[model samples]
Target: MHLISQLCFLLCAAALGNAVVLRPRDPVKYQLKTPPLDTPWTDKVGRSPWPQYPRPQLRRDVWNSLNGIWTYQAAAGAGDVEKSPPLLPYAEEVLIPSCIEGGISGLQKWGVTHMWFGTYFEIPQEWNSNERILLNFEAVDYEATVFVNNVRLGRNTGGYFRFTFDITDQVKRGQLNSLKVFVFDPTDDQSIPQGKQTKRLSHIFYTPCSGIWQTVWLESVPKNHITSVDISGGMDGQLNITVHSNTRQPTQVKVEIHGLESEYATQRWGFESDQLAKISVPGVKLWSPDSPKLYNITVKMGDDLVQTYTGFRTIKSEVVNGVRRPILNGKFLFQFGPLDQGYWPDGIHLPPTHEAMVWDLELIKGLGMNMVRKHIKIEPDLFYEACDRLGLLVIQDMVSMRVHTNARPSDAEQAEFERQLEIMVNEHKSYPSIVTWVIYNEGWGQRTDYFPEFKIVDRIRVLDPSRLIDAVTGWEDHGTGDFLDNHHYADPQCGTPYYSRLSSPYDQSRIGFQGEFGGLGHRPEDKHLWPVEGAVRTINETYEIHANTDSYNWRAHVLLDLLKQQIERYACSGAVYTQTTDVEGEVNGLVTYDRRFVRVDTQQWRTDIQALYSAAAGRA
Candidate 1:
């Protein structure tokens, strides 16, 4: 009976054209390429690289993940791309969410700029009943024009921020719907916030991600649904929430706040579109790296419901003794962590799985670090969620772009840059873990510092006055912002000055910070190294040591002493290590790129960090 039923199902599927069965699992047909080093989660990446819910802050229960094998084709040239959709089903296949350049994508077509990605999805009957069905893309590099059922939906321009489109009119209910996307990324060829992506991959810069590199999904929302929620926590116990809706009419919103650990009375408020609502919670525990407490919030208007979480904490700068310090919740605590370059050996710009991202955070926590300088790249919401849940303070950096060599951006370019910056702040402002925003890194894409009227830093301050602003992390200093930052990659032997000239009294209003230091390089076994043609081991004047347990311990000890000196002697409030993992040819990370092993002894590292924290506490 079982065999007969299976036979009947296959016959029926054949009768219906077998769209689900003939979804193309044969990799040879597509001629895909795999990376040399595979992460542990690489094989587990079956179809979807990150199948989890894309939006954690604004989440609905019923959603469909449009991730899996997708039809892929590299355009013949720029002229090959046209207004209409690409030819129906391409012979090549690429995995969604993973860029076409990365190994996890199954198509390691690196240099192709123009490409077409097509997939088919079914709109559930229940989803069709909703007033609106939305299609969302977590991120697409450079430029993207989307099409649903061959009908042009819209286009998005940013590579690091998420965008959505209403596909209610395009999708067919209870039937397979066609989705096509065209992406063009001119990494170094254009003046954009390309981060470390470059046409030439060498030194600090690594691989370039071209197409869809994050999650893609479909959501069912009401016509008058809640669009956004801006939650801000104050030191005075007041929780300010501004609930935004699509409808202009005033609507009754029920806000339910539940403490994950502590008991708190639920508060209610009536929400109007674009109006601010305030509520004070009694005995609110301030969120810190030590005790990161989050409150689950549910916002419901009419039939629209969305769930989100936020932590209440206050961040400010105050003079402790003679030196200014970043104070959190009216207390002084030194921040120290690695500069996290969110890159993977297999996935390049993205981690292979959600668990992989969480693993990196957990490793940082276990190493006794309190903060992470997310260097020059914006991660997905899942990264921020893990940081909030695990109590890791984040220093987010706006992606940098040097339009011209050490030159100012034209007026038109500056406007677009500010637009992207505003989107970055508005999208991630609700996350309590983000304490500082680094505006310019190593003078990338920065105008002449002499021009006080440039006012990019001022613009950011206007957008978000809650978090501290870092005008410049290294090299060129505008003599503004809350941190007098410097990037000093001292010699591994401590032969060079640990601090730079930025520590002078010229900026009395800013706190001293070692934005980057200690690029101690150590290449692991050949298996862990990223395989690239003519890939030279670009080790700085750091250290040359064996990859043994004892050497790794010594390296960790030396690093601790170096950071301790910065805190005690220079009164530096924070310091960021060169990086978390090695990228491409750079082998100066605490961990290998594949994430299979940690070079340092976790237990010893944690013990040393704990001692450092104790000393810092006494100083505070």
Candidate 2:
């Protein structure tokens, strides 16, 4: 009776306008994450575990695959309430490691969050007992309330970084156990890290992806597991590694260095050294797209062993002979690459397979570019691992949780923003590939900087000061990070070499990153399309009345040529072309949405890219 009265009162308050029921209003657009596995028109193999690599960038030989169908259904409400009635058949299914809003899940429509997914599986008995059970979630947008069996386990909110929760208490080996997840995303509601997603898909933005769109799996690790790893290569050219564990245990962890071992000297000490280890490789070749080189690393903690990899590299900017430019390995170098959406038709933001992730990086390198401004999103560690292994430089962006503002910080939103920012930096500080941190995203829904952009810059300095920080990209520059940034479209442009409009009291120690410039209008068409609609807004000029060439003109070749002209026109620190591939409504890509065809000739594009880079470096 007490509960019933409270429920009634809550409904009354909702009717009075304090709450919203969130009726299922149709989205103006929908992104198709997974199409039919067996497309009637293609030679693609339809297989479970679409992305096969456990770590796309960081390859490992021993790992289990956990991508396949998990019994799923949309609940009317409270899908797993202890006393709630069972959910109806749903007649629908969602693929594991895929978002509910995605086509790959077999449930293309949206609006509900109570998704019940169940799978029966077993782990070797040996994996339990002495070892701990860790459930790793690559990403689950907004909110992921997890359950093991009928017990409520735990929950996580961040959508970009990797998270692990111990389930040893609830999980049983060689037995059938149920795993349930509930997700809620108020996309662009100023509550979550909903970058550029809108309910009303118009202009350049498109629909939002709700539930899980990344890998979900389980791994067994010994009680004395390496919880975190921090990697860095200093001026001495020695690779440094610091490993943190769950328990001190005074464990003698064995270290295996892949490259020239003599160059690096290793000493093992328990919690005392914080268990720090260093290795040197003389004549070490730094990671660069043109001369891609990588090294491997394996660590053994107690009786447990884990294999991973890292690179030894450094990036900085300074005035050289009266010119400012980015430097790598003591040479005035130019950084050029793409704005990788990191999304795919098969997986939306989630790559279809591990191979899929590798393909994007490899292709970027093949294009003769070295850096990728990983635009407004954080990727799984494996993505960073890949960048580290394949010798790619990345400017990582912290996930934005609130709109930015110039007003004083009165709202908790600022605190929340800083909270997530710190978490991101803490988790990813170890990677050698990441060199910069991008704070506010496009001024999207900015309110107030939790810490002013510059203050936050100082905070990052205290946290992991080795890299640079760009407080805000393209606008509201508070002189943070180490670069001047600008955004242009369909053409080339550069900030003033000495003092950009945003740079006041700017030091020459840092230069500018073309950051964003070039919406080259190229379409690879069919294979790599985000969706046919975004690609064919108005086909051939005769499809619809809105198809006027002057207004709705997005024909293929015209866009590609425009991109070519833009790339040739601009000279900046490094040019991040509009993008690596097409996203939902943004058909400007070197490749189509489906990850198939290269709209531009690979060799020609590479030559042009290298030439422009050479020219830019010369000027710098």
Candidate 3:
């Protein structure tokens, strides 16, 4: 009977032009003239390029992932691009979501600032009956102009934020649809916040990437569907939810909150357009790094249903033992982890696969670190999701650009930065793991004027008051924001004058943190290393290591002891270790550049970290 049913289903699918059997074509492999260090996920890129659902926070089952291969061409200028119409054939094929400068993209040739991408996809007949067809781009670097079926959809600027266009009228039903994208990126131009990207790669600065560096997809929704849902946790143990709809119709919004282990509560409320639905979970389990509890949320309104999840916890600054420290869930707990710069040797800005991303966070957990400072670059949404599930706290940094000496941005550039800041907060506010936001790092792309820093801090606080803000991470403390962050390097035991500088008077209300410290270098003999021009230590200089185990033990002991001392001597609330893994030329990481070797013993590190957490909690 099962075989008969399967046969009938196959017959029905065949009758509908075999559309059910049709799937996205396998991505083509691009042979780069110069290859990068091979990772576990490198070979999988051509077969399945980030096959997971792009958006995990607000999920819909009825959507198509527009990832895989697409036709690509490089244009010299706008005039040269104007020579061809929309949906024009391309000279070569490049993998979507991988930048042209990377080995995975097939076209590793750099120096071309302007480029075009084109692809053809057939819309599922079932999705053609919706009132709105939205074409969503998870992210596109710098600037982008999109076209569908030879009709110009829209233009978007800002490389970090996501954007969407309503292409319901532009697409044809039951036919193949055409998509064209034009991208322009002026990396390190000083006007834009290009993060750590630079045209010329060097000691600190890395290679520049352009065009669609993230996922692109299409979804169908009702005319009066929910556009967005914002969730936050209150100290009073209540969940605050605001649902925004596209249409101004009165509708019933049902919210069901389910604990990961058990069912919690279900409630229905009348929502009109944009309405705030505050539901109280009487016995909610507060989320923490050790006990990361999450509640699955299901929202239903008429025919529109969306799924999401949130954690119940609170973060604030309070006086503990005569020193201002970060209080999570009304308790003083010291946060310690690595300054995670999300970059891959093979994928560059993009991770090779979802598993590789999860592996990084899992390693952090295995090492017993409770928090991670995501330095400079804003990662894809999947990264935040992994943090939430794995119980790791995140301090997200706004990507900085043009970090030259005394850099300043124009008024328009400042406005663009602020706009992207708001989008970043709104999009990822639901995640319970993100407890803080780092606005600027070491005065990169920051104006010397006080008003600009004041405005940025005020805007971030206004957007989401639940999370703490580090207005500036390293130098030039504005005396604003929630934390006075500092960066110290080399051996902490040397006891340089920098320790005395940490005693400088600052805001009494804010907490203190060593934003970056402990860059002890160690490189394996077989590891791939980028050429460094300057005089720097290639091996462990502070401690003599006769063997590999000695290297790992000495590095871990010195760093962990320094953190314990920092907390006791300076009343420091938190500290981010220099990095999680080695990158290109930088060999100061707990793990190797290719993630093949972890210097520290996982069991011993976890035991040491637990002792630090206990001390900060006032239990020891």
Quantify all predictions' global Cα lDDT against the true fold. Answer: 0.78, 0.60, 0.75
lDDT of 3 at 80: 48
lDDT of 1 by residue, 196-224 (tens): 88877667777888898888998888888
TM-score for each candidate, following the candidate numbering:
0.91, 0.79, 0.89
CA displacement after TM-score superposition, residue 288 of candidate 3 (Å): 0.9
Model 3 CA lDDT for position 176: 66
User: Which residue pairs in candidate 3 collide?
Assistant: none
Which should have the higher TM-score, number 1 or number 2? 1
Instruction: Give Cα distance to truth, residue 498, candidate 3, Å.
Output: 6.6
Could you give candidate 3's per-residue lDDT for residues 1-620 as a string of tens digits? 25653454355445333344422232243464244565666776764488788878788888988988787888777664454443334667788888787777878757777888887777788774856888999888878888886667778988877899988888778766778898888887546878878876665667777888899998888877887788887656688888777775667788777653335355444544466666666667788998888877887777888998888889998887778888889888788899898877777788878888888889998888999999888889999989998899999998885775455777777888888888888988888999999888888887776547677888888788889988887777768888877776653321122453533344546787878877766666554553333312334442233246576666667677767765556666788887888777677677776788877777777877776776676621
Superposed on all Cα atoms, the candidates' RMSDs to the truth, in angstroms, are 4.5, 8.9, 6.5
Candidates 1 and 3, the one with greater TM-score: 1
Candidate 3 segments whose C-alpha is farther than 4 A from its true place: 1-34, 79-87, 248-251, 260-270, 491-507, 530-549
Which 10-residue window of candidate 1 scores lowest in summed lDDT? 490-499
As a whole number from 0 to 100, the lDDT of residue 93 in candidate 1 is 76
Across 74-173, the per-residue lDDT of candidate 2 in tens digits comes to: 5555435443222211233456666565566556656665555544455656554666777777777767777665457777876665677888888666
